[model samples]
Structure formats: structure tokens, C-alpha cells
Target: MNTSTSGTTKNYRVLLVGDEDNSARLILNTLHKVGLECRYAVGAAAGLSAFRENNIHLVLLDLSTPTAETLCARIRENSTKPLLMTTAATDHQVPLIGLKVGADDYLLKPLDPPMLIARVFALLRRVYVYGGDESHVAKAPPSYSDQGSRLPEGWATCEACNYMGPSPRFEGRSRHGQSVMVCPHCRVPAAVTYAVS
Candidate 1:
């Protein structure tokens, strides 16, 4: 299903890091069904470089890739973007280690497409749609009241400080020139159309 908010079309970029071409193709195909643009990196180094060079909203790291743990740690150190680890190994410790290294979630290999899509969507919703705070219900921006173009008050959460409360409507432009809502509390750009195509 398309995850865009009502009355808005948002895009997100996903980085798939792995050495297995077949697995990458499968994962990319699954994600594309839901409108996410994906980039594939062959190994840890390439993955790290691609992530650094692009606006990657999420990362899917394959445990089979060499030095995947190091890549996870490196990515986590650099950004708060969501990371998911996939593996064929059933050892419980593998997922634990992946989590310890900063994966937000993990899945087994021979991947189930539906479950994969669900997890990816859930993470994107939690981070971008809800501004990283799950407690608040999403509300559409207030429409112009009878005052002729005057917008009613609105609420926003600062992705930096976790601040959530009411404020006047604050709008800005993203690096990609997309209109976004700025966080009043910290003056940081808070929400935007998330797709990166």
C-alpha cells in the first residue's frame, strides 16, 4: 500500500547493503512496490560511502556481507536513520549483536516480502511520519479559517529534542527544495515530504 499521508505524496530513499545480487534484487523489488526508491551497495565500504553521499532514510544491512557489524556501527555513529539487519543465521546471538551494534530491527533470510514491507513501513512511519515520537496522533495541518488565509494553531515535535506541543504554523524548504514544517522549539526543520527521488 502507498504510505503517503492524506493529501500529500512523500518519498523515501532506502539503502540496501549486501553482496548477494539475488537478495538485493528481491529486497529492492519488494520495496519498490510501496514507492520507496532504493540504492544497493555491494559491501561495507561501498555501503558506508553511499550512505554518506546520499540522503538515505533507512538502511537494510545483510549480515552475510563481510564486516556488516562494523558498517552498522559506523552508520549509527553518523546518523539516527533507521537500520534493519537481515540474516540467514538462526543463532539468537546474531540478532542481539545486530541490535547492540545499532540495528532498529532484524529479520531472517529467505525473507518474507510482506513482513519486510511491513517492517520498513513501520519504521518510516515512526521516524518521518510521526517525527520520531509514537505517542502523538497525526493531525492534518489546519485549514484556513474564516479569517481569510489565517491558519489555526498546529502542533509539532522537534526531532532533535523530542519537544511536542502546539505552535503557530512554521514552514520551510528542505535541501531538496521540498516544503517542510519547521520545529518551533529548536528552529530545526521538523517534517517534510520524505521521498528522495
Candidate 2:
């Protein structure tokens, strides 16, 4: 079954693909509480159709979905929005496979409300507000050196989303390699600078 339910406003939209009635209802309820609109589809065909027909900001998929991978690939072809997958299986490989195929994040279900909200917020923060860009400037801790110089600290601000964080993101070499600290709310790569009073 395919159903598109009207939500509060157009500020955000979600495409949910699954056949599990209880899980879908729980998710839809959570999304509605936060003022997000959702469109639900029971299988891959409906999911693909809805995705193409709507202006969706994120996709929440069930790993048990038939042709889950194919559906993800099809969605990725046109949209850059975040895709999150959930699974009931405990096997460690399931989430990995979802990530390998195209999912931006994976979750094990019997859904935890707080975790679900947090992940959704994080994804929405990055995709909708930041669009995966590092152009925004943020404040940094004075003790932190960025490119050898101590940057002035104040706050990292995203003009597009009005997101503010305590520290600007910084780039550094980790054991694994170089990694940049991104704003949790906007995903902007920030610089390490001293906080300005």
C-alpha cells in the first residue's frame, strides 16, 4: 500500500518505505510530533514512485524491504537527501550491507525513541540545513591551533539554517587519517579558533 499523508508544513518531508505496520506508525508519530511530513510506502515499487513524485528531504527504509538495495540506488540517482535504514535482525552484517549499498546511516530496531529522534535530527541538520558544505565560519577554542595560528573563538553560525555551535570545526590528522570536526546541527567544517568574549 502507498499512502501520502499531509503534514504540518513544507519545511521538511520524509519518505518511509516498509511494510511493518507498527514500526511505520511509530515513526510517523514521532515525525509528526516534530512537525515533519511523511509519505509511507509498503514496498519498493511504491517507494520509488513516491520518491519521484514528491519533494522529500529524507528517506527511512526498512532493511527487510524487498529489493531494498535497488530502491536505495534508484533514490540516490536523483536525490542527495539522507537515507537511513532500520533492521530487526541482530546480525552485524545487515547494517553494514545497508551502508555499503547506499544508506547514510543504519539502525537496529525495536526502535528507541531518543536514538531515532537524534539520528533523524542529525541527518536533517546536515542534509537540509548544511547540504554537506563546509563554507560556514564558526568560533573555536583559544587553546586549539588551526593551521598553526590560534583562531578567535565566538561561535559557529550557519546563516542558511540559523544553527549555532560552541566551536568551529577543525581539520586534523587522526590515526586513520585526516578528519574534520563538523557541526552537529549543520555539518559545516569549522576552523579551530579562540573564543571571542
Candidate 3:
């Protein structure tokens, strides 16, 4: 598990979106037992409704949830919180798509209960904390900070590798293109190409 301090003490409101009653209950139980605050919705609409009232810090979505992609898009437009998608054993692409849609992590099904728990903890920590990935980003010389090019608001920039992995973005338009962009240090590109995403 990636341990960090930023969000550790803050109470994060999490939205659990899934149709399976048993699985939701199990996850809810585990989170509560471990002392994490959360709210759960049975379907897509309900999940959005819950998000409307709660300051949700992260989302836990079942891969099979109806309207999953649309829901992800909606959430992506609104927040930069970490999204954790739950995928079944046969779905190899779920994780990939989840990230593309702005999910921060994914849990494979036939779920190893402990793994899911760890992911949630790590994600929440990152969202509220500044130092996990920022330790590297902060090391960058001020010259590296983009002045003309806009970065999606919170997208992290790694100074050591200069790789801007991922983060929440600013609203409306900015200097950044809002892609899953990489900084110059992630990997050197061929002279003909630019490291946009």
C-alpha cells in the first residue's frame, strides 16, 4: 500500500455504486469496521444523487454497473477525486478504460477483500494529502513550472522523472489540454514528437 500523510486524518465521504447487495454490504461493513465514513447508492442515478449532497472524496464503482461509462464521464467533468472501479476476472480492459475515464485505481473481482481496502485507503490519502507523489513534483526547479502551458489543476508533476502522472484539474479552460499528460522527465521522446499524454 502507498502510505502518505496528507489525507490520513480527514474523513472522506466515499460513494459506493453497484447493484450487488451482498458486495456492497461487505464493502460497507469493511470500511465502517475500519473507521472510514461512506455513503452507498444502488445504481447510477442514486450514486449521482448521493454525490450531489456529499463531499465525496473518491468513488467505488462496480464494473457491471449500468451506465458506468457515462457515470464516469460525468464524475470526471465534475471532480478530480480518485475513482476505483471493480472489475471481474474476465474483464481485462475495465482497468484501462477506467483510467482513461479518470479512474485512479481498480480492484479485480473475485475480490481479495484486503486489497480493495488497501486501495481505498491509499487513494483517499493521496487526494487529501499533498506529499505522496508531490514529493518528487515539489523538487522541480521553478523553471520547470509551466507558465504558458496550463496543467490540469492538480495533475502531479514529478521532478525526478518529470512525469506528470495524473491529478484532478481546474474547471473551464486553462493553459493545459487536460490529457493524461507526461512531463519532460517521464521519458525522453523522439525529437519529432511531443509528450502530450
Candidate 4:
């Protein structure tokens, strides 16, 4: 488990969407036991309503819902939070469909409590716990130099994955298309700019 430092405590809110009574109860109990705040809705309309009205950190959905794809699309339209889909369907194409609709992960039913918690932790770590692009973009240090377009060679660290190593050979573009350098270890943007030293 990742521990937050002083002044970094976070309140993680999960929006769970599913109609299965037993599964929903288990998930709710497990998440609460682990100290995460969660809200549950039995249908797509209620789920979307809850999500829009609250600050949800993650979304857990049951693929068995008739409107799962549409709900996923609607949620993705507004939030970039991690979305996970779970189903007991044996059809091989179900997981693929979930991914296409913007699910970050798809899991089968009879979910393991430890693994479920771990996956949730991993998602939270990537998006909020660690210094990801979302948290560091605004606070990025100024560009090293303005005279040259070429990046300097040196050791760099990935704030997203906390990987310290030599930088990659090429610069990568951000989601907004700005050229940025990424860490060789985890491939997350290392710095928005670099300079020859």
C-alpha cells in the first residue's frame, strides 16, 4: 500500500455501477474495509447521476449492464478517471468491447479482494499518488535553453513512475502535442524541456 506524506492525504471516491446485489455488496464492503469511500448505483441512470454530482476518483462498472458501453462513453466524455469493468461473460469479445469504450481494465467475476485492491491502488498511484502528468504539468520547471531545438544528454527521472535513469534518445509529444522528453525507464514525460549542460 502507498502511504501519503504530510499534506498529501487524499480522499478517494469510487463510483460503482452494477445491478448484481451480491457482487455489489462484496465490493462495497471490501472497499469500505480498506478505507476507501464508495457510492453504489444499480442502473446506468443512477450511476451517471451520481458520477456527475460527485468528485469520483475511479469508476467500477459491471459489463453485464445492458447499457455498459453507452455509460462508459458518457463517463469518458466528462472524466479522465480510471474506469474498470467486471463481468462473468464467457464471450471473448466482451473485454475488448469494454476497452474500446474507454475502460482502463477489465476483470472477470468472482473478483479476488486483494487483487482488486491492488489494481485500484495501482490506478490511483499512476494518476494521483505519484507525480503524474496531471499533477506536474503546471509546475514543470522552465525550459533549459531557447537557442537550440536539440535536447541535452543527461540522467533524468520519470516523475510518473519514479524511475531514475538516462533519458531516452528521442523527445516525445504530450497529449496536447507539445514536444517533451520522457524517462527511459517508464516512458512518462521526464521534463517539458531540456538544455545542453
The 10 consecutive residues of candidate 4 with the worst lDDT sum are 1-10
**Candidate 4 error regions (>4 Å):** 1-10, 131-197
Please identify model 3 stretches exceeding 4 Å from their true place. Answer: 1-10, 131-197
TM-scores, one per candidate: 0.62, 0.66, 0.60, 0.63
Answer with 2 or 3, whichever has the higher lDDT.
2
- Give the per-residue lDDT of model 4 (tens digit) for 1-197: 11111112234777789885788888887666555667888788888888888677788999988798899999999778889989898897998999998999978888977456656655665676453545522222211222122232453434454333334543577789997787654565644333346
Alpha-carbon local distance difference test for all models: 0.68, 0.67, 0.60, 0.66
Per-residue lDDT tens digits for candidate 2, residues 38-148, read 789999998988888886778999989899988988887876678999999898988888888789998888997646755775677666445643232122111112113
Decreasing lDDT order of the candidates: 1, 2, 4, 3
Candidate 4's C-alpha lDDT?
Answer: 0.66
Query: Model 1: per-residue lDDT, tens digit, 1-197?
Result: 11122222245778899985687888887676556667888899989988898677889999889999999999988798889999999789988999999999999989987567657765766686667443323432221221122111253344454334444345666789997777654667744112111
**155: Cα error in model 2, Å:** 19
How many Å off is the CA of 25 in candidate 4? 0.6
| Residue 43 C-alpha lDDT in model 4 | 81
Instruction: Tell me the alpha-carbon RMSD of every candidate.
Output: 13.9, 10.5, 13.5, 12.2
lDDT of 1 at 36: 67
